[model samples]
Target: MHPTIPGFTYRRVPVADDVTLNVAVGGSGSPVMLLHGFPQTHLMWRHVAVELAARHTVICPDLRGYGASDKPAEDAEADGLTYAKRTMAADAVALARALGHDRFALAGHDRGALVAIRAALDHPEVITHLASLDVLPTLDTWDVMHGTGAAVGFHLYLMAQPPGLPERMIGASADAFFGHFLDIWTRDPQAIPADIRAAYLAASRASVPSVVADYRASAGIDVVHDQADRDAGNRLRMPVTVLQQDWGTALGFDAAERWRAWAPDLRHTTVSCGHFMAEEAPEDVVKAVLDLLTR
Candidate 1:
């Protein structure tokens, strides 16, 4: 059987036309929606979800095109819109509404953070609190990424290429491609047990194209939408918190300052953890989320 949070009830909730998300809901109280990142599924939130569920009804869902969620076929002409964060953000909002929530706290890691950012910007009325773990806004990300420093993100550029090549390349060695991030992005290897690691690889292997489409959107249409928001001075109108590895100096940008421009009431913290903070340093993540909820 696939790994799942022990006490959560699972459901396939329709979020869009011909698309439904695989969701795990547990606990009761104020609702909080959690979105999982790439190379992982909603199970990534198993630890955090359980902890948060003690006081809040936690909703964890595999974002569209990832994990067990629906992956709609994308026509070439769609121009990455099918997997754009805006599209995924809408799916998150829809999922929350279907789950009997009109507005809720939102938190995401990596790719999911991008979707959370877009959701906050587009549906401010629906997101009451926001937390982004280890990522910048799409526009800020592309802006700060440059030169040899950008080499760390080789996968980003790879998936950004026009459809076929990326799909074929990643599909050819799906395990290695996805496993590389899983292996290197964590400091506490024990945080993800053998079964969990296998589950992640298996899920990623099966969704190579959809996963690439998700990343490709970040490099293309996501940037455009973020740029449009920036041009209009649109920012997240909610209590926002961000957690990240202290790599801003190496990347030649002030992480907190960058986030401050977008999130006026932002609480940005630099942690000594790897990219998968939610799994590796779940207590820290939980504390941050709990604090944000109070704000």
Candidate 2:
């Protein structure tokens, strides 16, 4: 059995025909769902979930095609929409409803934040509040990347290629590929214990293809969806909070300004931490989530 959030019960909740997310739910009071980032599972929120559970029901789920959750096979000819944020976001909503929540506050980190953004955009009625850790919307993400600075996201361009190559290459050395991020994107080396690091690598190694598909969709269909929303002038109606590393000065884009366009009632904070904020700075993350909920 995988390491789980203490006090949270685990279950497989069906969100789609062939997809059931591995979910860890605990606490009571108002409901708040926490989505985990890439190369990790809901266990990433083990620290924060336990803290938030003191005053709120916290639901954490291993997204479809990730962790111990079901990974639906996609043929080579597939369009990559299967792992798109729109689809993934729907899975989040369905999982919440399956757990009897018609409306709840939502928070996500890294890749999971993309799904949370799309969920608030597409189903505003279902998400009462939103918190995104370390990510911009799809359209804004592509807009900010250019020249040498964009090299940081080499994996994005790598996986954005036409299917076969990215999957084969990543699958070939899955541990090293996924472990690279866990090593470098962390400020506090001890933030993730040896056991948790091993769990991340193991889970990521087992789901390479689906993980690649998830990123590939981010580069393709997700961009299209965000563009359409931009053209339509759709914005997040709920209160939104964003916590991110100070990447603007290096990347040459106003991170908060970009977020302000989508989130009107927004609190954009630049944290002194690495990409894995939940693990590296769980106390700060929990504070931000609690503050957002109060808004």
> In lDDT terms, which candidate is top?
2
Model 2 lDDT tens row, 151-198: 999999998888689989999999999999998899898999999999
Per-residue CA lDDT of candidate 1, range 1-295, in tens?
9999989999999998889999999999999999988799999999999999999999999988888999987757887889988999999999999999999999999999999999999999999999999998988988988999999889989998988999998999999999999988888889889999999999999899899888888888999999998899998889999999878467788888889989999999988888988888999999999999999
TM-score of 1: 0.98
lDDT of each: 0.92, 0.93
Question: Backbone clash tally for model 1?
Answer: 0
Give the TM-scores of the predictions, in the order they appear. Answer: 0.98, 0.98
